[model samples]
Target: MNAEGTSTAGATPATVTTIAGSDSGGGAGIQADLHAFAAHGVHGTSVVTALTAQNTRGVTKAEPAGTAMVAAQLDAVLADFDVRAVKTGMLADLDTLALVAEQARKGRLPNLVVDPVMVTTSGDSLFEGDPKQYLHAFADSPTVITPNVIEAQQLSGTVIRDLADARHAAETIARSGPRAVLVKGGHLGPRSTSDLLYVDGRAFTFAAEHVDTANTHGTGCTLAAAIAANLALGLDLVQAIDHAKRYLTRALKAAAGQRLGSGPGPVLHSVPVHSAPEFATDA
Candidate 1:
């Protein structure tokens, strides 16, 4: 059995596979996801979708992995491991996104958390032109999607400037077919940090007082990955999002005084144990 008290002989560790990019800075993308998975006591695996030369300041360069290679990486993991949940980020091109969406539709994957990472908080564009059409395709298959306000706006073609707009965008995207949408309000305004979850024809808002810090480079990736980790551990969707938001808030607090790069810096993705429940169960 593994440390989480799960059997591992005929089965592997309760694994959450992340199909995303690699951040050389070790702040966001695959690195952040892996860190969050480990911290949450879940096994982590990754298929690199792109490689980025980025620091806290911004992405200076990006080279996307070919569609064939991306597909192969996912196949290798799924064939050998029991991936309970999947989270995706930073697919640098439309073709890569399409490939991912196709595989998921063909039942080659499991519970998916799609983080529609369109543009970096630093104002660097991650996807190329007309990426939304591809995002809509992937969003159509996933169990859940986590999109910040800007990405939500781009995906829904509607400005998500407030909570009402967020609801509208969530409704629009839900029409595209995801089971749930979590529109992150991290970029909404400078006051309260809010995340709106639209599921089962209802909207649930998770709000937190904004933590003022420069070390927030990989927050979005971390949140989605944390939620994926919770799902892998057998939590339901609502419980997973609840735990993820609490975990992220604690991470932001821990990172308040730390510094990673010369630029805006990265969050310290560690939180104390008492801050969250040991595990969540549906029953």
Candidate 2:
């Protein structure tokens, strides 16, 4: 403990996998995700589903990898590594989504955290199909799905205006397949940042101070990856989300002071972490 007497600790480092598009910008996508896993003291592996030639400014070009190549990459990593968790981002099309779903169904993707990446945090539209249709494929497993407000709207076909709406939207998406649904409220109006976590039959509201900054480039991916990191550390559902949000708050605050990009910058995940929050366990 530094200023305070409270001591905190991070979990032992373990391998985790990120199945996502390669972001040249290094702010969002796979690059950001790897950084997040390291920040959580977790080793990270990857399976590239797509590659984008873009920067903080915007996406100049994007090309998704073939389903066969994506599958091969997944196979190699899952077979070789003792991956504790797997999180997905930017499965650019139905084919990509279906491939990952196939892996999940085959029990190849463990502790799966699916980030239904339809739109980018930088206002890029990647997928056009209904998210619910794609999600139905994973309904058999108890996966965890994280979607921002707009994404939640796309996946749930429900308007998210307030906490109640967020809850309803999360529940609807949870019904699609995921065991837990986290509807991120980063797109909402200025106020306390909130997320609705709907699992099984209980819903918990997670709220935080909205850091007014443009450095929120990979907030969604980072949060999901962080949660997976916590899960790899063996924290239960509630505890993982709670710890992940706490990490995000500090990261956003730390990144607010950076000037990495002329446009929106990235959260500083490599920075030294301070006191940790108490996490719930599966006692």
Report residue 142 deviation for candidate 2 (angstroms): 4.5
lDDT of 2 by residue, 152-230 (tens): 8988888989878988888888776678888888887766487778888688877777788888788888899888877
* Backbone collisions counted per model: 0, 1
User: How many Å off is the CA of 6 in candidate 2?
Assistant: 16
Mark the regions of model 2 whose C-alpha exceeds 4 Å error after superposition: 1-12, 273-283
lDDT at position 202, candidate 1: 87
How does each model score on lDDT? 0.82, 0.79
Q: Judging by lDDT against the true structure, name the best candidate.
A: 1
Candidate 1 weakest ten by summed lDDT: 274-283
Candidate 1 accuracy as TM-score: 0.91
